[model samples]
Target: MKLTIERAALLKSLAHVQSVVERRTTIPILSNVKLEGRSGRLSLNATDMDLDIAETVPADISQPGATTAPAHTFYDIVRKLPEGSQVEIEFKPDDGQMTLRSGRSKFSLSCLPVEDFPVLSGGEFPFSFTLTSSELKALIDRTRFAISTEETRYYLNGIYLHAATGSDGAMLRAVATDGHRLARAEVTMPEGASGMPGIIIPRKTVAEVRKLIDETDGEITVSLSETKLKFAFADAELTSKLIDGTFPDYERVIPTDNDKVLDVDCKSFAQAVDRVSAISTEKSRAIKLSIERGTATLSASSPESGSAVEEIEATYDSTPLEIGFNSRYLLDILSQVEGETARFAMADAASPTVVREVADSSAIYVLMPMRV
Candidate 1:
C-alpha cells in the first residue's frame, strides 16, 4: 500500500488508534496497526483482542493494498515530523518493510501481514441510540473515578450504564462504585434505548472511547448487543466486549432516610479535607468531620507525624455529630460538583453519608464512614 497524507490529519487518526495497542503482546500482530489504502482513503485500525478502534482519514492513494506496521513507532514518527509536512508511506510486499518519507527525514518500519490482525465483530444490535458528545462525556467524567481497581471483584471494575427511573421519570443512568464510595449520574433518556440490555462496560473500553470523543457538537451513535458494544463517533469507530458478570444491587446501599442535613461550600470543604489529610499517615487516610449547630470542623492526627485541625462555616442545625471518612474518598465525590454548595445528609457516624450538589439533583454520591 502507498499513500501520501497530510501530517496533521494522519496524526489525528493515528493518535486514537495507536493508544489501543499494548506495548507487550504474546501475539505479534497485536502490537501493530493495520493500514488499508483504497482509491481515496486510508483506514488505520488497532486492537488488543477485547477492544478494537478504527479511524479513517483522507489520503492520496497511489497504490491500493493493506499491511500492518508497528503502531507506536509509526505514530511517533508522524508526530515528530516537521509541522505541515506531507507524509508518504509505501509498503513493499516482497521485502516486508514499510517506508515513511517526510521532507528531509525517512523511517522504515517492519510490516506484518494484514490478515493476522484480529477484528472484533458483533451480531445484529437490536438497541441503538444517539447522544450528544457533551452529554455522554458528563456521564463518564463523573462516575469513572469511582470504578474499582480490585481484580478479584471484577464486576465493579467499570461503570454500569443502563436505563433507569430518575428523579424525573425515565432516564439513562451511569453508576460506578468500589464499595467504599459510589457515584451516580443521570441523563435524559434518548429514544431507542427502551429495549437496551443493562451492560457493564470494561474500564479500558470506557477510557478509549472517552479519548476519541472530542468537544465537537457531533452526536455519537451507540449500538450494543448482549456481549458487545460499538460507538461510532465522527470519523472513528470503537468496538469492545462487555464485562461478563452480574453487577451487585446498588440501590440497597443508597440511604433514603438520612435527615441530618449540612450545607457547605464544595471547594472550601475539599480544600480543608486535603490540608488535614496531609498530616494523616494511616493507610486508610481517615479524617474526622465534626458538625454542630452552624459550624463544622475537620481534624486528622497521626502518632508518628503531627496533627491538623480546621474549622469551616456550614449550615447545620442538628445535634453535634462526629464522623470519620477517608479523605481521598470525600474529595473524590466533592470534585464532581460544579455548584458552589454541597449538601450532606448524615444519619450518625456509623451509616453511609449522602452527598449531592445543592442545585443539581441529577447526580448523587454515597460515601461509607471509617473509624477514626
Candidate 2:
C-alpha cells in the first residue's frame, strides 16, 4: 500500500487512535495500528481487545492496500517530522515492512500482516440515538470522578447509564459511585431512549469517548447492544465492550427527607475545604462543616499537624448541624457545580448529605459522611 498524507492531519488522527493501543501487549499484532488506504482516504485503527478506535484522514491514494505497523513508533516518527511536510507511506505486499518517507528522512519499519490484526466486530446494536456534544460532555464530566478504582466490586468501576423518569418525565441519566460518594446527572431523553436498557460503560471507554467528543462540535451517534457499544462522530468511530455486571440500584442511597438546607457559594466552600484539608492527615482527609443560623465554618485537625479553620457566610435556616466528609469528595462535587451557589441538604451527621447546584436541579451528588 502507498499513500501520501499531510503531516498535521496524519498526526492528529494517529494521536487519537494510538491511545487505545496499550504500551505493552501480549499479542504482537495488538500493538500495531492497522493502516488501510482506499477511495482517497486513509484509515488508522488501534485496539487493546476491549476498546477500539478508528480514525480517517484525507490522503492521496497511490495504491489501494493495507498493513499493520507499530502504533507508537509510527506516531513518534510522524510527530517529529517537520510541520506541514507531506508524508509518504509504502508497504510491500510480499515483505511485511512499511517505509515512511518525509522530506529527507526515511525509515523502514517492520510490520505484521494486516490479516493478523484483531477486528472488534460491530455486533448487533439494537438501540441507537444522537446526542449533542455538549450534553454528552456534561454527563461524563459530572459523574466520572466518582468511578471506583477498586477491583473487588468490578461492577462499580464504570458509569451506569440508563433511562429513568424524573419530575420532567423520561430522562437519560448517568450515575457513578465508589461506595463513599455518588454523582448523578441527566439530560432530556431523546424520543428513542425511553425504554433503553441500563449499561455500565467502562471507565477507560468513558475517558476516551470524552476526549473524542471534545475535539468536535458535531453530534455524536451512539449505538448500544447488550454486550458492546459504539460511538460514531465525524471521522472517527469508537467501539467498546460493556462491563458484564449489574450496577447497584443507586436511588435507595439518595437522601429524600433531609430537612436542613444550607446554601453556600460553591467556589468559597471548595476553597475552604482546600485550605483546611491541607493540615488533615493522609489516612483521613476529612473536613468538618459546622453550619449555624447564617454562617458555616470548615475545620480540619490532625494529631501530627495543627488545625485549620475557615468561615464563610451562607444562607442556613435550619438548626445547627455538624458533618464530616472527605475533603476530596467535596471538591469533586463542587467543581461540577455550574452555578455560583451550592445547596446542601442534610438530615443528620450520620446520614448522607445531598448536594445540588442551586440554579440547576438536573444534577445531584450524595456524599457519605466520614468520621472526624
Candidate 3:
C-alpha cells in the first residue's frame, strides 16, 4: 500500500484505532493495526478479540493495498512528526516492511500479513437508532461511574441498555451498578429503538465510545443484535461483543418508600464530604452524614487519623437521621448531579438512599449505607 496522508489526519485516526489494540497479547497480529489504502481513503482497524475499532481518513492513494503493522510503534512515529508534515507510507510486500517518511525522518516497521489479522464479523443488527452526541454523553457519563469492576459478576461489569416505560412515555435507559451503588439515566426513546432486548455494553467499549463522543457533535448511529453492539460515528466505527449475561432486575433495589428527604447544595455537600473524608480509614473510606431539621454535618474518624466534622446547610424536614456511606462513592454520585441541589431520599441509616437532581428526573443514583 502506497499512500500520502497529512500527519494530523493520520495521527487522529491512529489515536482512535490504536487504543483498541491490547498492549500485551498472545497473538502477534492482534497487536498490530490493519492499514488499508483504497478509493482515496486510508482505513485503520485494530481489535483485541472482544472489541474492535475502525477509522478512516482521507488520503492520496497511488497503490491500493493492505498490511498490518505494530499499532503503538506506528502511532508514536506519526505523533512525533512535525505538524503539517506530509506522511508518505509505502509497503514493500517482498521485504515484509512498511516504510514511513515525513520531513527528514524515515522508519521501516515490520509488517504482518493482512490475512492474519482477525476480522470481527458484522452480524445482522436488527435494531438501529440514532442519538445526538450530547444525549449519548449524558447517558454514559451519568451511569458509567457505577459500572462494576468485579470480574466474577460479569453481568454487572457493563451498562445495561434497554427501552423502558417511564412516567412520561417510552425511554431508552442506561443503568449500571457495582452492588454498593447504582446509577440510572434515560432519554426519550428514539425511533426504531423499542422492543429491543436489553444489552450489557462492556466497560472498555463504553469508555472508548465516550472518547469518540468528544470529537464530534454529530449524531451517532447505534445498532445492536443479541450478541454484539456497534456504535457508528461520523468518521469511525466501534463494534464490541456484548457481555453474555442477564442483568438483575434493578428496580427491586431502588427504594420506593423512603420518607426522609434531604436537599443540600450539591457543591457544598461535596466539598464537606471531601474535607471530612480526609480522616476516614483507608480501607473503608467511611463518612457519616448526620441530617437534622435544616443542617447536615459530615464526619469521619479512624483509629490512626483524627476525626473531622463539617456542617453544611441543608433542607430536611424529616426526623434527625445519621447515615454512613463510602465517602468516595458519595462524592462520585454527587459529581454527576448537574443541578445545584441534590435531593436524597432515605428511609433510614440502614436502607438504600436515592439521590437525584432536583430539576432533572432523567438521572438517578442509589447508594447503600455502610456502618460507621
Q: In candidate 1, which residue ranges exceed 4 Å CA deviation?
A: none
lDDT of 2 by residue, 43-93 (tens): 999999999999989999989999999999999999999998999999997
Clashes in model 3: which pairs?
none
lDDT of 3 by residue, 1-372 (tens): 899999999999999999988899999999999999999999999999899999989999999999999999999999999999999999989999999999899999999999999888477999999999999999999999999999999999999999999988999999999999999999999999999999999999999999999998999999999999999998999999999999999999999999999999999889889999999989999999999999999999998989999998999998999999999999999999988999999998899999999999999999999999
Score every model by TM-score.
0.97, 0.98, 0.99
- Which structure is stronger by TM-score: 1 or 2? 2
What lDDT is obtained when candidate 1 is compared to the true structure? 0.92
**What ranking of all candidate models by TM-score puts the best one first?**
3, 2, 1
Stretches of model 2 off by over 4 angstroms after superposition? none
| Candidate 2 clashes between residue pairs 3 or more apart in a chain or in different chains | none
Q: Candidate 1 residues 1-372, lDDT tens each?
A: 889999999998999999999988889999999999996999999999899999889999999999999999999999999889999999999999999999989889999998888878547877899999988899998899999999999999999999998779889999999999999998999999875889999999999988877635699999999999999987888999999999899999999999899999999999999999998876979999999988999999999888999999999998899999999989989999999999999999999999999999989999999999
lDDT of each: 0.92, 0.93, 0.95
* Winning candidate number (lDDT): 3
